[model samples]
Structure formats: C-alpha cells, structure tokens
Target: MQAPGGAILEGFIDLLVEDGDGLRVVDYKTDQVALKEVDERFAGYRLQGAAYALLAAGVTGRPVTRVDFVFTDSGEVRSLAGAELAVQVAEIRTRLERAPGEEPSGGGDDQLRLPGLNGS
Candidate 1:
C-alpha cells in the first residue's frame, strides 16, 4: 500500500509484537532456501518492516527495536534488531525522499562508467 505522503511501501507483514522493550516486526516466508543477508527478498521485507515500525511507533509512541523474517519451509528465522533496524529505516526514508538526479551518498550508479558511452 502507498502511504498518504506517496511513499510506495509494499509487502504486508504476518505479525507484529510489542512489549516493554519495543515492537517486533515479523514476516513469514515459505521459501525452500533460507536467507542470511539483505538479498532481494530480505530487502523487500526490510522495507515492509520499517513501514510497520513507523506505523507502530506512531500509534504506541515508542520506537520499534526489531524486525524479523521467518522461513517456515526451512525453519530458519533471521532478524535485524535495535538501533541497526532504526538506522536502516532512516536510510531507506532518506532514499525515498531523494529527488530525481540526486544520487544517494557513497555513489551507487557512479561506479559503473559504461565503456564507450562516457569515454571511459
């Protein structure tokens, strides 16, 4: 779903848990292989988690400290928590706020100078 402000937030989480520490964003996957890092599936889910965290924080008035992805098929669960998740969310929000032609910090597309196209 798209946020009212126009951010294209995608993916719906399976569950959200909250307690004294903070909110925990949980998403279930039925993949055959388990994921260990921020690959495509993980990246997509991470954004979804961040969006959920934002919504939960607004409602509860407390920061969300965790986001998790559970692969039921493999029975493997991976999680990103605390300040790290917060930082990731912030970084994603920054990317969403960027205007056209504005490159992200640390040079994403600048590294590849397409041989003959730009006289490399």
Candidate 2:
C-alpha cells in the first residue's frame, strides 16, 4: 500500500475490524513486556502500528483510526489513535524517505528485527 508520503508498505494484518466510521488494526504479539511497560516498551512498535494503519487505510480506502497491540505475555493492550497515530505514521514515512547515505538516529535502527539487517 502507498502511504500518505508515498512510502510503500506491506504486511499481513492479524485482524481488521470496522469501528463505526473508520477501521481499526489489531495485532497480536508475544513480546514479554510487563503490564506496566505496555505503552512505554511499545516505543518502536508505534512505527509498526502506524505502518499497519497506513497500509490498511491505503488498501481499503478507509480511515484507520486505531491500532491496538495485544501483548499476550502480559495480557495488556497498547492503543494508538487520533493525533498520536498520525504523528507515528508521518515519522515512518519520513524515515522511509531518508537519503540512503544518511545515518539513522536512536541507535541507528528502527528496532525491527530482520535477516542481516539492524543486527538481527
């Protein structure tokens, strides 16, 4: 899906539910974050949730107003919406648009683990 800033996004959505006038993205995670750290530890996941929101909105032509991260390990849910959601999505797009030669901030990685990248 093409995001607002022209960033291409693709992912397998765990669940999609209609929420009145908009859609909500729900993702199940096994991360072992404690209940108290649900939101704080969700730092980088904010980008991932934003990506899911952007992808779903672009593909379905519907506003993705919510992204919920369900941490089964702690049985906690971290939710992002409204302004916060928009901010994160824009951040992801900006990251995607960065020049190839520029070094990334915050430990030089976006924290998404992958094969042969970001120390994964």
TM-score of each model, paired residue for residue: 0.60, 0.75
Name the best candidate (by lDDT): 2
Q: Which stretch of 10 consecutive residues in model 1 shows the poorest summed lDDT?
A: 107-116
- Return the TM-score for candidate 2, rounded to 2 decimals: 0.75
Summed over model 2, clashes come to 0
Top-scoring candidate (TM-score): 2
- Cα-based lDDT at residue 115, candidate 2: 20
Which regions in candidate 1 have their CA more than 4 angstroms from the true location?
A: 1-11, 34-45, 100-120
| lDDT of each residue in 4-97, candidate 1, tens digit only | 3344434345677875677787777765654553254565555456656665565667877887877787677767677768776686566546
